[model samples]
Target: MNGTGNIVALKPFPDAARLELDDAQLRTNLRRATHTIRDKRLRVVGEVDDWEQLRLSGAAIKDDVLARLPELLERFEEAATKAGAVVHWARDSAEACEIVTALVKETAAREVVKVKSMATQEIGLNEALEAAGIAATETDLAELIVQLAEDTPSHILVPAIHYNRSQIREIFLSKMPGVTRGLTDEPRALAEAARKHLRAKFLTATVGISGANFAIADTGTLVVVESEGNGRMCLTLPQTLISVVGIEKILPDFSSLDVFLQLLPRSSTGERMNPYTSMWTGVTPGDGPQTTHIVLIDNGRTATLSDEVGRQALRCIRCSACLNVCPVYERVGGHAYGSVYPGPIGAILSPQMTGDGANKTLPYASTLCGACFDACPVRINIPEVLVHLRQKGPKSRAEHAAFASISWIMRDRRRYAAALRAARRGSAPLRGRGPLRRLPWPASAWTVSRDLPLPPKESFREWWAKR
Candidate 1:
């Protein structure tokens, strides 16, 4: 695979195998978690009479923001610079990684605590930092579990959804340093264990790296909302803070934060309010992070913005509600998506980020059930985008050819009747069984995992004529 290119041939089955072996446990955890959150979200969302209107308004705001992203980004840079933040622009993941790595090296910080940042993950920042001899410790409880297990985040919000409590206990017992010899599969125990491990890092680390949930252009303020206080600690305790955020993450002003603050928490963890909603503008002397640097990353986001239908994905607040509702995502989980963003959002976002060609299969991963569209807080029409991409996809070429051939066959009624007669004659071999016991080659491959329905003995037109 190219360093920054999409992993087109990446199989979901391998990651699924690891998950399936612990199927009973994962099912129990997911069932409990998803049901609880689903109920809470429906209840809270119902309280607002204009919920649909709010969704439409949110989507419109994002569309408007994306329309003039270039202008707004420059405005953000100017404002942030005025507020004492040093702004660095990176065109791609490599440049972003290099900029972050160089910044950390210049600070001479060997260890850095991290708030859960998807941009950092997208650019492989931790790996880059490690290569530069910097240890990046993940502070989020789920992220810590993922980092310790050397596993990739399956879901954007819940990174370790693939791991059950017992699996987490196994990981802690094996990976966490100075952890108790025996660990139970209790949530409280796991959280305390993580807290002990990360508290030391938070107090001692000189630098912190984070991704903003939203960046306000008007005041140059960066926002991060999380259920855990660990993000707050990571953002505050470190002396020097480096935030890697996508340029597309910028909102026009601070007022826009109200719409997202309401949309994100309820949609994500199903909370009425997130425990920690942190916002900071540049450097504040005697406060959180005396030195602040924002690395504005444009890695494929600009390319995604250029796309008409696919651009709506940029509006995502990284709320994983769509994932929880997607049947395919519910079964295979996020690892199968093979990108930093996963599930329905990832399907549309990944192909757009990579540009459609050989990696077009990402769009087809959905069943087009529209469950994701219904669940999306921002009302991203995931099914519409999926079909749009499919039409522009590589498979469409073959489909077009098939259509032309079928059209040619159907143009002449005599040929069509002869074809149906041939079909009836050929299918005579399987008449007693009602359908062929087994097909051959390509046709057989379709039936390998499913049974084929028997064709009618007579054509519909012929039956109509007889009547």
Candidate 2:
């Protein structure tokens, strides 16, 4: 994972152009994945009579935690250290990468097995490790697929949701050694092949790197919740375990853990309870890892927190429920967002963390339909934040100058009416059943997809006056 600042600097234009061309395949993959998870989520959530109340509680708890993040982080550091875990604080991505790289180098390990950790992806840890001549293997199934394909994750929970079965089979045949050449697109065959490939790495690796779903400040316990048992294996099998987590992931106590444990699984994978929920407080004698280190990263999170409207994005648990429900994401897919965090969350989050320059186009990608807000378990008001970012966009000096000229012409009734009349006249040559056939430059981008309505023969004000 690269820093949010650098990662967000790479916007959707180049990626989106490619994704839009793959519309059919994206639709098929998104329809299959989203429909399955959406149905499961609704069923499990409906089982709880007070689902709305639980959502409210989750939102309130996160808000309270964010309000006191600095204090809670200090408390977490104290507690973790007391439990024999070395705590490292990183102010940015470069520092975090440097710390992790140095630690891995100290162990003199060339290869490390990894559990699926979004924090690692957020910082481009694998790439950083590779740059330092260390090999980081992703053991999680979806993450493995992503790594093998040399593609970025499309969804938070299901990194390969954009890939169909055939695509996956092709990836395996090309990447995995000893994989059956005649593999079909069956789920069982694919899973078996991945299992076989990862087993060797698990047994041989001396060090493991992971990201925690939550870090408890009270007892200094780190929690990882997952559907697969791979995380459990990675945490325990290695002599050295390094967990890199976002500063925002800290919870006040085990009591607070009860709320997230219940909410996260159901919201994310639509599971009643996660199959593997691993919790460890430092290191145990002759058990798991003899050495444990926790790296708390604050890469762009503090900057995002400084903005009142954007702060709510920090509460995201990466459930990706919002992603599954997002219409734009369903169509364009995650790669188009050009960030580790994609979909609805990425749209608002990327621009704010990176600032509104070229990346400013992301927030405008959505229709502001508020579907993401409804689907988010923590109740992040995505639509509000998106609109807030849009307001920030036109205020840029370059943007203001462009719109300012247009504003001047549209200010007076006569000038506006004349402009509309001119538009109607110009569109005469493009007369069709619907609207104008073609538009100029940047505006043509919008017209390429759907027809732009031509100006009416008369303004509404003129009709009203006549009446």
Candidate 3:
């Protein structure tokens, strides 16, 4: 399942970032979008007087859920089943995919409409469904664009964030069936076109699949908060409905929504609240889908939970506030991280979710600016986790040797003075040179985009002795 998932980074983050950085247009798009969202979030978040207290409460709730996860999961299953939902457990991605595909096939449907779901993406569910001859159509406007363009999602909340209006117009005109050639790049026109395109799918699709923003163990309710009504349609309009949820998504009770429902929308879309918040309890017989299934997927979550510091990543509500504020994410974009979940969260989450074999370099992809933790609604200390994960990674021989030499020198006064004297002599020629140009190998890497200031002409000990 890990092998089959989208968590694997095809290349190391540095190499991927190097390639992504060359795209000026991409950088421009990312800067505009992230800044807009960042400014909006700051404004709305400021409106709440007790925002910090709310963040603390949200984190405490999620931590408690993780601590009692085993019991909470069972309670959720029991309550969901009692409410007429068929709850299924999946140990990994493969099992989750198999379970969903089988459920879809049981409805005798060739096509299924979907609400945007990170868990489904994590399992590579669409690709798996395709292999089984079932078409999983993404009904969300942004997801549909990415799917039509054969592109992976670059951002958590805005999947098509990398694409500008003109590019989106081109995609719709070229890829969308029955779309008018005159479709303009205006936001309204694009929304209209997508709405018309998805309307038929929503009406006729026999199966719908979704991921929950929250699953309440107390009442067996699954909640999805979105700006568009597509999620509501998916929740209501189908012969059968299935939801793929991560075990971490569960809350101890229905009241937990009071905190998250407030935090998620504001932190994600910069909205005081989402326009559409859809909740369902299993099935409603003739009113909605007759058959309801909930597949709770582990897929290495247990492994992630094993970590003391890293377990905090599971608290992510997918608000993506961190992505909108991250400097590295703004410049290089999400594709560089090579995961559906990107930015500060992905750098920590993706590595622990899969293993050391995949995304080995992700932990290093940060400035440790601490912006992410500040933006996080649940207050995941992402930089702390990133540093923790970095410590767990394979040590660099050159770095280890360099630190070892420094340690050895610091332990003895003679070596320290000798090292200082050598440095002073080597830097004398470059003194008052402002900043040295790119130096030779090893040091060249640091000097490429940064200045290397010349050291003092004499060591402190030498100056004292001469005086």
Candidate 4:
């Protein structure tokens, strides 16, 4: 959702994907980045002797959380309140944004520093804050790059994964104010430039906005795992901190962090452990934020939770492993999906979380490759959920009529034989050849990158009768 109660999609997947496929640079960047991460993840994941068992444990813990979501949310609110953090519940993205905007206004701060937050992005919090005349500065290096370039994130973990070093250097030189001339495209140089740009914002901003990787119900703690120190700065430096988290991100207790912390870093950044792991419970007197607020955002998660089969998507940990391993995402990149979340996980979760309007096409974005399922640290059966969403989703009149016709023809033996006879005659020109390079209108979409198997000259029924 785009924080306005709207399902955000500029166009269907096929249309956006077609445009993205034509971008040679995007395809090249995605191929290189995803493969590098995929190889590294495989190497690190191989180092764990009990990886599969850990995945099972993670999935079980998440399932239990989903099953007991309501109870846990109340428990979390009570604990956070007791710990001096005000807890607010938002029924949707609009309400969440409203609550956060009001909270920032109360701090009387016209500017806010932000950590890398998928939840905020999902609800368009930056735009909301911008409308309120509050400037939200992204402190994370990749997020800063994306913000400077005025682009949406294409990858979950790495917001600027679509850009190469040279591209980033160009963005910083042009968009980042006061950048020195002749800046190099070296990784260290780009990082140093970003660090300098964000350091001032971190020190001056009074309010910070963030999303949690996990929210522990037992202690009302929020956990953020990151490779850079930016998250730490955002968490501690601000006087007023407001965290907007999804309800599904909640876990039963602090112990559950044992399994997820191990799973998240390995799957996301391909590290055995993140460089920085920050956990905050309510307000810590004179330590972190003096005033703390936790906004628990439902934002259609309850609807997603209502679906028996689709609810499995709630088990996601935002690791981005599914994206790195997905062939379709590798080709099209994240912008084509047109959501804050993208890749295989987005293919299923987007439709369910926002309902099957513009995002219904996402369910069909995959080749049904099981790589995403295999790569998921929590073992969320993504392929199964994709198929389930498609089966239960809307269909165009043409698709409905075509299926109806096929079913009618198949129901009668005589009609079925006649259909096969017509098919052989219709396919006669291509019968002796290899896979057809192209087909007519509706089937043309399928044959664009693939070849269809030519129909046989004779039906099996006809051959049997003749023999």
Candidate lDDT scores, in order, read 0.82, 0.85, 0.91, 0.89
For residue 378, what is the lDDT in candidate 4? 94
C-alpha RMSD of each candidate structure in angstroms? 2.9, 3.0, 1.9, 2.2
Best by TM-score: 3
Q: How many pairs of residues collide in each model?
A: 0, 5, 0, 0
**lDDT tens string, model 2, 98-190?**
999999999999999999988898788998999999999999999999999998888899999989999999999998899877888999989
Error of 2 at 172 (Å): 1.6
Cα error, residue 119 of model 4, in Å, equals 0.5
Error of 3 at 157 (Å): 0.3
The positional error of residue 13 in candidate 4, measured at the CA in angstroms, is 0.9
For each candidate in turn, the TM-score is: 0.91, 0.90, 0.96, 0.95
Candidate 1 per-residue C-alpha lDDT over 26-59 given as tens digits, one digit per residue, 9 for 90 to 100: 6666666666777888888878777787788788
Top model number, lDDT: 3
As for candidate 3, its clashing pairs are: none
What's the TM for model 2? 0.90
Q: Lowest lDDT 10-mer window, candidate 4?
A: 1-10
